[model samples]
Target: MTGVVGALVEAWDELRIHRLRVLLALIGVAVAVAAITAVTAAVDMLSQAMREQNERDSGRSVTLQVNAWPATAEAASTDTEAIAAQYDLALERYGIEYSSRTLYSPVPVRFPDGTRGVDMQAVDPDLGVINRIVPVQGRWFVDQDVDAFAPMLVVNEAFMQSLGLSDLSTHPTVLIGDTDPVRATIIGVTAQRWTGEMPSAFWLYDQFERWWHVDPQMGQPAPTLAVWVPTDQADALSERLARDVQLAAPGWQVDVYDNRMNGMSGLDGATRWIGLGFGVFALLLGGLGLVNISLVTVRYRIREIGIRRSFGATSARIFFGVMLESVVATLVAGFVGVAIAVAGLKAVPFDRLFGSALQDTPPFPVSAALVGLGAALAV
Candidate 1:
């Protein structure tokens, strides 16, 4: 330990004597390390945030969708009621929590200015756990009004803008399909949808039933049902549904997706390789700088080394002395690089790109710093 301390002291003395050279080498290493640290942190934050968002968007709480066909031929055999019961039972059997909803069609919406378009949706007030449509402005539909003739419309932000509607207080009137105009009130607006290649619009499902002339007891076919299952059990639940439920139409499809699966296929093996490539490049650059500094220091100290050798200094000691100098320089630069990276991350706005995950944590990677220090010593 004393020998190591002495070597470190000597290395520091030599570094102080050649302050300019040390600073230049330190700058190079700092740049490399800072770049690696910041990029890695940003990527890690982005990947995590995206995964969480995908899970939320996929409705991890409960499955959702409208049933197209009913189990019974009677007009009273609306599959909506039976399917909700099935979802409830399934959740109980698996010791999992769940919810469900029925979607209605597009209702004709008229703004205060009389501009109009079809706003599509239908929702179950009680069992909708996944994609719970919280009202931003007005209340969600109550059970008493489920069969009411009155239209209760929930317009999304984009739909509101397109129809020249400004505020929920405007008491916007909407026509359900070709039916008589029903005064639907604005209730809620959803947050912006997840980032993707597709464009998304927000709307209310409760008012869609009045406009589309759908009677829950009319026993009509539904277009689709969205279901949310626990990520771990998504595949198993989907398979069970497939084997147990007989579809009225042979071509009907059951699609299952979870949050983790979203954007996952796109990440691919190439992304890992790319990260490794950048890491390797950074290590190589840092190592090269250290090696160049070592060679120069050795060249300048040849006469000193020769004098020490004449005094019975071992080659092993000389080699260790040289390596120790390189390691000291690299470790110093590595720490500075870590500091710069942390400061720089604080100055940037990564929230829009990475969301709450980056906002909640520090961006430094301790392991990377250790690896960089080791690589510099090896070089």
Candidate 2:
């Protein structure tokens, strides 16, 4: 170990003496390493953003969607509350941690101008976990919101704008329903799905059922139960949930299927490969330039090498002494580059870059730094 330390010290000393000759090359190497590391981290964040966006649409990985509806007109009025109960029981039986029952209906809201019908979603608090629903301002629903005197709402940006509200700072309230408009407070605002999406809001399932009357023509949409489970258990759970739900709600059409985003692994893989390819190409160019500089430096140092040989230095010592200079220089460069990359990434506004706040924002991947360092060492 001492011998190795001495050799490393000697190499570092040589690098310091010849740094002026290799300064530009070392800078190139540092830039290349930073580029590679940054690209890797960027790809990881992009993939995470894509995954979060998909989760908002279809729930997270291994999400099982359960649908149950009456098969005949006579059974059309099948008790939805009972179905929800059965869904809860099933979830309890499996000890599922994240599950939510969601139903969609339109409710009339007394806006400042006039009463307007707005799209409404009745969902449980767990929906936030299963769907990665991050509110842009304020907070999502909690279990306590269920017992509040009035219903709580989480509306989109458009919904808040229609009510002439800038934010939830004042705890905005809007009257919902036409008969006896029940006052609902807007606790959160979510980003619009598009620039001009219609005003929509989410209400807790139980509160919505108790407060909002279902239209006869627009009868309550069938509730879809979303349960997030382990990927490996999805197929088995899907089959079991289908059988159990069917038996629980007799004469109803019951279906269970995986609703998590599909075919994204391929796209993520391609993106990573493409980004890595660019990084590697840059690294090669820098490596080639460094190699040329090193060759010229070695030619100029022939007398120094010969003097060491005359002083009884073995061939191995000379070889290692020469090689360690490049290694030590690159290791230093890699460290500086990685530090810069980490700092730059931390300062990035990821929410704006991805168009949404990432629920599980990936940390600076350790593997990315490893790759950068490994490439530097290879060069």
Candidate 3:
């Protein structure tokens, strides 16, 4: 240990003496490490951002979507209601924790000035959880919101702007109904990112069914039940739920759909491939920079090596000492680079930078920093 320590001290002294050379090597390693680290972290952030965007559009990972229709095309108005009851029953039977019923209906809303058709969605409270709905303004519906005399509504930013309603402090009401307008309170406003400029609103599924007369004769969308389960159990649970629903409502064609396929296949693989290519390029740059420094270092340190050899330093010791100098110097440079990268990322607001793409991504991924340091050491 003492001999090793002595050799390390000697190697460090040589590095201190060759100030210009060490500076050049350190600069190269630092730049390379920072480049690799920043690229890795940025790619990871982008991937996560895209993930959040997709989840908002579709449901979250391992989400099971069930589309059920009564066998007879010309069904009584009672049939849709019965079908919903059976679906809800099946959900309870399976002990599903997070589930939502989405009933998409184009309802005309009457503003103070004029009325327009808006995409009104009726959903259970869990719909926001399954879809990861983070409101920029207020919040999603809660269980207590269901019991209110008037159906609680969450509107999009565009919807609020269209109505020319600025303040959300005082609860505002919108007239939404097929016949005489059933007044619904706008409790919250969502950021206009997921839903486009088109006006949109959300109401409690149960309240909408109770208050609004959704005449099946008018040709409206059948409610879709979105269920969230563990990723490993999604397929199995969905299949079982389909079987149960069929038994619950005989003559009902139950179709279980996996919404995650499109998101996972289309977005994840593409981002991974793009990131892998860039990561490799970064690794090469870092390694090549270190290799160049090491090559030049040996030529300059030949005199130092000869003197150490005269003092009984073995060939292996000399070789390892040279390597250690590079490792120590590069390691320090790697840390500096990582610090700079972190500072750079923090200086610029990533959330603002990504805007819509950014969601729930941690301020910085420590793993990416560690990986950067490791890659620098390898170089």
Local accuracy of candidate 3 as per-residue lDDT tens digits, 1-379:
9988987897789789876877776786787778777877787787788777777888888789888776665533336656677777878887889999988877888876788888888899998988888777788899998889987888988888887887688677878764677888888888876545788898898898778766666755368889988888888888887887677666667899877667456666777668657765866776676688778767887897899899998899888888888888888888998998888877767777777636476567787788778977787
Q: 228, model 1: CA deviation in Å? A: 4.0
Candidate 2, residues 181-249, lDDT tens digits: the string is 899998999888886699999999889878976753366546889899999899989999999888877
For each of the candidates, give the backbone clash count.
Answer: 21, 0, 0
lDDT of 1 by residue, 1-379 (tens): 9988988898888788877888877777777766666556555555555544544456543343334454355633434544445545555766644444445444445545653445365655543345444544555555666566565555555655655656667676544344455555455544444433121123334445335466555323553445666656767776666543334333333344344444554773445457657866876776677668767878988999999899988998888887777678877877787677678877877665554333235445666556545544444
For each candidate in turn, the TM-score is 0.71, 0.92, 0.90
Candidate 1 at residue 306, lDDT? Answer: 100
Regions of candidate 1 where Cα sits further than 4 Å from its true position: 49-79, 98-104, 113-117, 123-154, 163-220, 223-227, 243-269, 351-379
Which ten contiguous residues of candidate 2 have the minimum total lDDT? 213-222
Error at 104, model 1, angstroms: 4.9
What are the root-mean-square deviations of the candidates from the true structure over C-alphas? Answer: 5.7, 2.1, 2.5
- Answer with 1 or 3, whichever has the higher TM-score: 3
User: In model 3, which runs have C-alpha deviations exceeding 4 angstroms?
Assistant: 74-78, 194-196, 263-266, 286-290, 357-359
Order candidates by TM-score, high to low.
2, 3, 1
Best TM-score among the predictions, by candidate number: 2
